[model samples]
Target: MGLLDNMKARIGPAKEKVSHLAQRHGGTIGHGLERAAKLVDEKTKGKYSDKIQAGTGKAKEAMDRLAHRSGRSPEKGEAPQAGETPRSASPPSSPEGPPPVS
Candidate 1:
């Protein structure tokens, strides 16, 4: 097998194990992520606020996926809502149409 293939083969089991752990302890993991993000933001005085927010969002998304609680279906285009905007609606448009055809 190629090096990449061999590496993947070895890491597959570890990934599965991590998924299981995340599922079992997702709440704790999510809390830890929030706490860590808050501490980091405080330490940096919000200079990296955008990056910290993005990372926290990604971490929560991963935790949700691992816990199977994201409410997104592979076959469905819309995310399940708890005060979230629906995916079917277009975002707000400008009054002008198509920029006067260039």
Candidate 2:
């Protein structure tokens, strides 16, 4: 087989293994991401707040995907108990108007 094909064969299992690992340890991984983001934001004195926020969001998304792939719900079936906003109650940003024409 060609080098490229050989490499792909070798790496395929590794990729799946990593995905499984991510799913199994998704909670811990997500917690670590949050802690790291907090530390970085504190260290930067909130100077890079926007970038830090974006990174945290992306990390959460990755964790969600991993969790879902492993047959876990993003949120356990706890209804909007106490002071929680339901997903549908939130105001639409562009309810009446089309998106901006760019």
Which pairs clash in the backbone of model 2? none
Candidate 1 structure quality by residue, lDDT tens digits, 1-102: 899999978877776677778888988998999899999999999999899989998878766665564332334575643434555668888897566765
User: Measured by TM-score, how close is model 2 to the native structure?
Assistant: 0.59
RMSD of each: 8.1, 11.0
TM-score of each: 0.57, 0.59
Q: Which ten residues in a row have the lowest lDDT in candidate 1?
A: 66-75
Model 2, residue 17: distance off in Å is: 1.1
| Candidate 1 similarity to native, TM-score | 0.57
For all candidates in order, the CA lDDT equals 0.75, 0.72
Model 2: per-residue lDDT, tens digit, 1-102? 999999978877776676788878888988899899999999999999999989898778866655455533225554543333454555656657776788
In model 1, residue pairs whose N, Cα or C atoms come closer than 3 Å (at least 3 residues apart or on different chains), thus clashing, are none
**Residue 66 local lDDT, model 2:** 53
Clashes of 2: 0
Error of 2 at 2 (Å): 2.6
